[model samples]
Target chain A: MTPKISQFLSQKNPSTPCLVVDIDEVELRYRAMQAALPAARIYYAVKANPARPLLDRLVFLGSCFDAASWEEVDLCLSAGARPENISFGNTVKKVSAIKAAYDAGVRLFVFDCVEELEKLARFAPGSRVYCRLLVNNHGAEWPLSRKFGTTPESARTLMLRARELGLDPYGISFHVGSQQLSADAYEVAIAQAGSLLADLAADGLRLRMVNLGGGFPIQYRDDVPGIAHFGQVISRAMKIHFGETLPEILVEPGRFIVGSAGVVSTEVVLVSQRGRDEGPRWVYLDIGRFGGLAETEGEAIRYMIRTARDGEEVSSVALAGPTCDGADILYEKSCYTLPVTLEAGDRVEILATGAYVSTYCSTRFNGFAPLAEHYI
Target chain B: MTPKISQFLSQKNPSTPCLVVDIDEVELRYRAMQAALPAARIYYAVKANPARPLLDRLVFLGSCFDAASWEEVDLCLSAGARPENISFGNTVKKVSAIKAAYDAGVRLFVFDCVEELEKLARFAPGSRVYCRLLVNNHGAEWPLSRKFGTTPESARTLMLRARELGLDPYGISFHVGSQQLSADAYEVAIAQAGSLLADLAADGLRLRMVNLGGGFPIQYRDDVPGIAHFGQVISRAMKIHFGETLPEILVEPGRFIVGSAGVVSTEVVLVSQRGRDEGPRWVYLDIGRFGGLAETEGEAIRYMIRTARDGEEVSSVALAGPTCDGADILYEKSCYTLPVTLEAGDRVEILATGAYVSTYCSTRFNGFAPLAEHYI
Candidate 1:
C-alpha cells in the first residue's frame, strides 16, 4: 500500500467502497506545480473530482479554477473561489450556462466554432474568449479525437469573428490530450499556437494569452516525468517558438493536481473461481465501472490496486464491480494480482483515484450507492 | 423514428436529452409475459429501471420484484410490492444489506458461494436460498463471465453448506445470459440445472424451486422472437429436463420487459467534422456513456438511434456526448446515420433505452444532469 493510504487507513476506518481524498497531498501537488511553472497561471480543472472539500482546500490555497459549466462555476464560487479566477473552459456549452456564467461575473470563456462564438456574443458579451487549436494527440494515454479545438485557419477566423462581435479573443488554447505522456506533443502544440499568435499579430489582432490545456500525466502504473520536467519543457518550447514576445501563459492541470491525492478503499465482496478450479479467480469489489471507476473502461487507465493483506502469496485475479450487469467487469484481460489469502471483507486501496472519480460516479446502479467520499 | 417516440414527441415537447418511458408499453409487455409464461412467476428486476413511477405501475399491475439490495427492496416495498413478493437476487451482497433485507421480511435470496451462504445464515437464517449454476454464455449479447454463478460442483457444495449453516437451500438458478439470443442456451442451462436437482435429490435434499434468471432479449436493431417464443421454449425445456417432477418456476426479466418500453430523446449538442472536410461528421449528443448510455461501453449493446428528421437525406456521423472527457464518446467506429441537416438542438430518440439508462446515470459529470425521466 502507498504510505498515503496506509496513513489514511490508520487514521480512519471508512466504510467499504469509499473515496478518501488526502487534502495535504493535494496541497503538496498544487504547490509543486505552482513552483515548477512560476510563469504560468494554474487553473485547476474542476471536472476532475469536484468534491467540495478538495475545491475548498484549493480555494484556500489561492488556486484558480477551470470550470466546464455554469454548475461548476457555482461550485467554485461556493467553495470561495473568485469568479475572476474561474475560466469557463468548455468550448461546447449551453447558451443558458454561458449566460449564467456571465451573470456570475465570469469573463474568460473558450470557443472553437462560430456558433459557440455567436452564443458567447449573445450571452457573455464583451467577455474574453480563447480559441482552441486542434493538435495531433498521438501518444497521449487518453487521446481526444476531434472533440474540442479547431484548425489554425478556423481559429484565426473565430478570433476575427470574436473581434467583429465585440468579444475579446484574448488567447489561443490547445489540449495535447488527457494524460499526455510526450513533452514533444506540447512542444508541437505550443509551436503551432505561437505561429497562430504571430499570424494574428500580423493581421493586427494583438492576442495576449496562450492556454496550455490539461493533459499532464500522473504516475499510475507507469513512470512519468515530474511537474518540473513538464514546466521546463513548456518554458523552453514557448521561448524557442515565440522569441522575445512570450505571451502570458495559463495552465489547466486536472489529474496531476489531484490524481495521487485520492485513494479509493474498496472491499472484496467475493473471491471465487470460474469454470474449473484452475481457472482465474474473480475478485468482486463493492465498486465497479459505474461506481466512479469509469476510467477503467477498456482498461485504458489501470489503477494500482493493493490488498490489505500485504506480503502473502499473490495470485492474478480478474477484478469486477458488484453489479448485476455483466459490463460492470473492471479488469478481465489485464488482471490484478492480489494476495492469495484475500477473501470477502478484505479491503483493497486503489491508489491515484482522486481525479475523475467523485464527479463521474453514477447515482445508483444495481442499488449500489455512488462512491462515498471522505476527506483528511 | 420509432412509432412510440414519434407519438411521444407529437404530444409533448419535453426538454432535449430526456428519457421518455412509455408506461403503457411496459404494462403491455408485462401482460404479454404473463400470458405467455403461465407456469412461471415474473419478478421484475428493479435495477433495469428503478424510476419510482415505473415501479409503482409495476406494483399496481400485480408484479413481483427481483431486488439486488436493501435499497431496491425498499423501492419495491415503497411502490407497494409485498415483501413476500420480492427476492434478493444478487449473489454478492453486503452483510448490512442482507440484514436489512431480512429485517424488511424478505425470505427468498440467491447465493452462489459458501461465503455468501454463511452471510445468509448469519443475517437471514432459515430463508430460502437459490444457488446459481454456471453455464456457457457464448452467444449472449451481454455475456456474464466469472462475475456471477458457480460450477455444478461448487453449487452442490454451497447448497449442502447452506443446509448445514441453517439456511434453506430451496432452489437452483441459472442465467443463460443477458440479451441471450439463442433458445438452445436455455435448453442447455435448464438441462444442467435439472441434473443438479436430481443429484441433490439423490442425496435426500428436496429442492422445491427452479429460477430461470433474466436475460431475455428485446428487439433493437435485430429482429428477436417475441416473449411468447421465449416462454414456450422455457416451458418445453423445463418439461423435457425435469421430467415429471417440475419444481415451482420463477422468472426474472429485466431488459426484455422494459428495454423496448422506453425511448431516450437526446438533442444534438454539436454537429461538426474532424481534420478535413472529407472526414466523417461528428454529432455530439447531450448524453453519452456517463450520462446513462453506459451499455454503449465497448459498443457491447447497440441501441437503435433515430433523428426527428426521418426520411430525409442521410449521412453517417460519429456520435459523442457533450462531456469534455474523450471516453464519453458513444460511437465513433460504428457510426450512425442521421439526417444531413441535423444540427445543434435537433432531437434524436434512442429506442429501447428504458431499462439501463436512468439507473446508470451519473449525478453530475461535466455539469450535465442525469438523464431526466418523463413517464407517459
Candidate 2:
C-alpha cells in the first residue's frame, strides 16, 4: 500500500474487506502516464473501479475515458468529462445502448465486425467508428477474451463497410492484452496495425487515428517494466512503422493508473491448520473471489499480501474467502505463506488492488454484503 | 423453460437478460425430494439462490434452511422460517455472526476446527454443533474446495473439544461436493462418518445426528442419476453403516430443489461469424460470467442454452458475455452448437440457471445491472 493509503487506513480504520484508494496516488500515476507518452492521449478505462472520486480526479487531470457501456459513459459525464472526450469502447453492444450513447453526444465508437458497424451506422449515424483487430494475447496476465476483435482480413472489409454505410472509418484498435508485461507484445501488435493501415491506405482510405487499446501492466507481486519504457518502445515502433504520417495516438489504461493506488483491507475470519490433510494452513478472509477478487480466477493475479504478523515466523498457507462456494478459494496451489501468529480478526492488506476489485464484487453472494469502497 | 416460464416469457415479454422462475416448479422439486429421501429432514441451502420469494415458497413447503451467514439466516427468518429451523452451516464464521444467530434463537451450527468451535462456545453456548469432515471430491462437477471441512481425525478432535467447550457435539457432516453425479460418493462419506461416529461413541459421547450435506445434482445437458437414486443409495448406506443406530438424518439440497425451476432469458447482443478465423460462430449474450453465470468458471456447470432458432440447421459456436474482459468468454472449447441463422436480439434461454444464477451476478462489473430476477 502507498503511504497515503496506509495512513488513511490507520486513521479511518474503516470496515474490513473494504477498498481504500488514495486519490492523489491516482493523479500521480496519471501524470506518470502523461510523461511516458506525451503524444498519446490517455483515455482512462472506466470499467476498472469506476468510483466517482477516482473518475473526478482523472477528469480534473484532463484524461479522456473509454467506456464499455452507456451507464459507464454516464458515469464519466457525471464526473465532469465531456462527451467528446469519451470513446464508446466495447465492440459487442446493444442497439438500444448504441442509440443511447449516440443520443448522449458520444460520437467516437468502436466495432469489430460488419453487424456492429451496421448497428453503429443505424443508431449512431455519422459517428467516427473504429474496428478492433484480433491481436494475440501473448504476455498479458489477465488477457482479454478472443470474443473481442475481428481478424484483420475481416476488419479491412468492416472498415470499408462502415464508410459505405455513412460512418467514418476513423481508425484501428488492438489490445496486446490486459496486464501485459512484455513491451515486445505492443511492438508486434503495432506492426500488425501498421500493415493494416498500409492495406487501408492503398484502398484510398486515410484513417486519422490509432487507438493503442489498453493492456498496460501494473506491478502486483513481480517486477514489471515502467510505463516510460513502454512509452519509449511504442514511440520508436510507431515512428519506424508510420514514417512521417503519425496518426493521433490514444492509449486506454485501466489498471495502470489506479491499480497501485488502492489497497483492500480484509479481516481474517478463520485460520485453521487442521482442515487440509496434506497440510497447508487454510486462512479464510472476509473477502474472496465472489467478494470482488475476480482477477484471482485461475490464480493469475496474485496480490502482495501484507499482514500485521509480517516479519514474524511464517509458514505456507492456503487462502480462501468467507463464502460457501467451492470456487471462492483464493490461493491454494500458488504456495502463499503468512505469519504463523496470524489469526482471526487480524487485518490483511491486499496491495495493488485499486483496479477491478470493488465493482467485480458479487451482490451479496452467500449473504455477504458487497465489498465496500473508501476514497481517500 | 417450463410451460409456465415459457408462457410467462411469451405473454409478459419481459426485458432481456432476466431470470424467470416458475415457483410451482420449485415446489414440485421439493415434493420430489421429500418423496425420495423420506427419512431425511430437508434443509434448503440458501447460498445457491437466496431470493426472498424462493425462500418464502420453500418455507411454505415446511423446509428448514442451511445458511452460510447471519444475513442468510435473517433472510430465512424474514421469509417466515423459524429460528430453530435454520442451521448456521458455514464452517468459517465471524464471532459477531455467531452471537447474532444465537440471539435470534438459532441453536444449530457447523464448524471444522478448534478455533471455530471455540468461537461458537463463547458466542453461541449450548448450541447443537456438527463437525464438517473433508471427504474426497471424486465424482462432483463442482467440487468443494479443500478449504472447507476438516480431516476426519481433526473433526474427531474438534467434536470432542466442542463437548468440552460448552457446545453440544451433535453430529458429523460432510459434502460429497456440488453437482455430485455418483451415488457412491455419499456411500464413501457415510462410511467415513460412521467410523468417526464409532470412535466418538467409544469415548462415550452419544451423537444423535448425521448431516449428508448438499450436492444433489439436476440435469443440465448430460443425463445423470436422479435424486431418487441418490436418496436410495444414501438410505442403504446409512442403514449399513449405522446398523440400528441410525441418527437423525439430514440432507441439504440446494441445486436439485431449484436448478431446473428457473431459466435465464438473454438477448443475443451480437453474433459474428466474421470474427474468428478458426470458424465456430461467435454468439455474444447480454449476460456472461460476471452477470451470475459464475458457475461457468472453467466451463464447469455448462447451462444448456435454448435459442429461438434451435432445430434449424445447427453449427458449433463460441459463446461469451457482453463485458470487455477477456475472461468473460463462456464456452470456447465446449462444442456448443446453435442455428446458423441466429442473430442479434434473439432471445436465448439458459436452462438450469435457477439455483446459482441471479445471486452470483457482480454488482455492476461493467455498468451492466445485476441479472434481473422474476418469480412467476
lDDT of each: 0.86, 0.91
Quantify how close model 2 is to the true structure by its C-alpha RMSD in Å: 1.3
DockQ of 2: 0.79
DockQ of each: 0.56, 0.79
Tens digit of per-residue lDDT, candidate 1, span A19-119: 88888899999999989889889899999878888999999999899998788999999999999999999877777788899999999999888877888
Best by TM-score: 2
Give the clashing residue pairs of candidate 1, or none.
Answer: none
**CA deviation > 4 Å runs, candidate 1:** A1-8, A202-206, B1-12
Clashing pairs in 2: A144-B326, A145-B326
Which candidate leads the pack in lDDT?
2
Worst 10 residues of 2 chain B by lDDT: B272-281
Write the residue-wise lDDT of candidate 2 on B12-103 in tens digits.
Answer: 99998999888899999999999999989999999888988899999999999999999999999999999999999999899889999999
> Evaluated against the true chain A, what TM-score does chain A of model 1 have?
0.97
